[model samples]
Target: MDKSLILNRLKNIKNFATDTELANFLNISRSTLSNWYARNSIDYDLLFSKCENNVDINWLLTGNGYNVKNESNVLAEPIESSRKTKDPIYELQRVPVFNLEATMGLVPLVDGNGVDEEKVIDYISIPSMPSCDGAIYASGDSMYPLLKSGDMIAYKRIAVERAQIFFGEMYIVAVKLDDFSTMKTVKFVHQSELGDEYIRLVSHNQHHTPKDVKLSQIAAIGLVRASIRLHN
Candidate 1:
């Protein structure tokens, strides 16, 4: 596959945006954009869905495919059944995982597998795992000694019942920045003896120092119930 052709197509169809500008618009960094420049081809469905319609998938993927929206119609649930189930109650659903790779430089998973979200495999339902909105496969040795890259960590969303908790507790937290969401393991946020509030997070590895994040920036929190690491 000719990647330069796709890049050239992207440049021509970029609507006055530079490559970096186009990448950021697609919620991907410049480096990631550069990395894809060498690929022979790409899965248009997955890539375009993540890009959120900023670029023409057909043109960016297959050089000859036209830029057109593909739509399909499907049958809806029975009207009578839908009407009867008006008072729907939602239990804690599948875990929500933020993309750390394309969006950030976190762990990368198998892309374009087209896995079904509804396919609840028994492997994902271990009783030892904590109840969470979802699980995230950890990346990097930043949390080494405790968590390794590709370890599946279970998490529970922070809520009223979970707020006002004490320090030293291990939790999965989404750190919201001015432009991005960073996921990290949090130990606790507390006020020092001087009355200054500090967010303190620990590193499992001895080489890395503990980090202090501001309390005001914690977007969401979830308790870490269990983690499963791969042997190989």
Candidate 2:
């Protein structure tokens, strides 16, 4: 795709005050944008990440769908007669939400041992969800509009030994460092050219650079099953 087309589309949608503001919003330097324009090449991944939720990914990439998302008409739930009964209480599974700080602190404890549920700060009941071991509140803009800060993500725990990473899927991975641990999304997993195993972490917001983490640093992993976004 031509980078100029994407730049024009972005300009039309945002109508930013200036090019500097647009560059800041996209988290790219002016030189980088100029380079992309000169080469007529689009960084699809970065563009998609920056325009997530607001713009239709299909339209942006292939020009096959509506430019903007129509959230209301997208997934209207079917009305069931049972829902009109006197008692409308639905069965739900309660998943514990752990404190982000404590969850990171507990990464080292997962050296073959399971997560300590004692660190959980609270619990929430969700209906129509698959079996989830725990939940965590998102912390950074790395995931941007699709998963803004404070969004709840339910995940099923995966044993370290039996963990099989699904490339291009989202995951909550705990990385063990010398004195602390951190959590991020796993974008892709593959062996390096030198035959060393590594996993790439990507942010939905393009400003954050993708990181390649060695397999040795991974302490625990969870397969993300569902996400609950609480809008203000």
Candidate 3:
């Protein structure tokens, strides 16, 4: 759908002074709306439902035909109800995409009070996608074949106390090195032959061998939920 037209019409209907007000009316964050504008697509059904019976579906979606200001023939509700019977709208989960440059990276995202409002670059909404806490850009090809550089990795935080190590699974892991500096990487975590005190980080790339790190040095861990690669 053409979000440009839809966004313009929304501003006209609501008499909104800014896009932030429109996002608030839709019960979504400004980042979500900005993402929609950037993607050039939107959930018109979600918009229609939230607009109540004020807007005409045709006008709201395509920006044509009779609208609220045109006449009293607002058919938004009827069309909405009809579509609900045929195809119900599912609420898509919106994941905050945080910029690694903003903080120490994924570690800080899952470490403390969660998402830093200042660090959030944007929000992404995916249909039928798994629940995710936050997302960061994959930098290296350590997990190549399974992941590549610049891929968006959606992850859910693992509590420090209840950190369940699902061995042999992909995770965004952060560890403290011998120099007390933090190292963040995406790899398949395995049980270290060294024993319960450490874990093995494996790479899918054959040339890269698995390495072990002390479990005590682990600072943060997040289970990888989904991966998205945007096309130009």
In model 3, the runs with Cα more than 4 Å from the true position are 1-90, 101-114, 160-163, 178-180
Better of 1 and 2 by lDDT: 2
Better of 2 and 3 by lDDT: 3
The segments of candidate 2 whose C-alpha lies over 4 angstroms from its true place after superposition are 1-91, 103-117, 161-163, 183-196
Clashes of 2: 0
Point out the worst 10-residue segment of candidate 3 by lDDT.
72-81
lDDT value, residue 30 of candidate 2: 84
* Deviation of model 3 at 7, angstroms: 43
TM-score ranking, best first: 3, 2, 1
Ranking by lDDT: 3, 2, 1
Q: Tell me the deviation in Å of residue 110 in model 3.
A: 9.3
Q: Residues 1-232, candidate 2: write the lDDT tens digits.
A: 5656566556434434245656787798988877877889867788878888577676555444344565221122222234432211223555677765644522321221233456777777766454455688888787786688888887755443223455666778778766565655533333344334676777677888878777667766766777889868
lDDT of 1 by residue, 1-232 (tens): 6675555454433321246655664576777777776555444555567534444465456643233233111011112223321211122223335443223212211121212234322234443222334466777786776887888876544421222334666676666665665555534333333333445666667677777766555655555656778897
Q: Which ten residues in a row have the lowest lDDT in candidate 2?
A: 71-80
lDDT of 1 at 167: 60
**In candidate 1, which residue ranges exceed 4 Å CA deviation?**
1-123, 160-163, 183-196
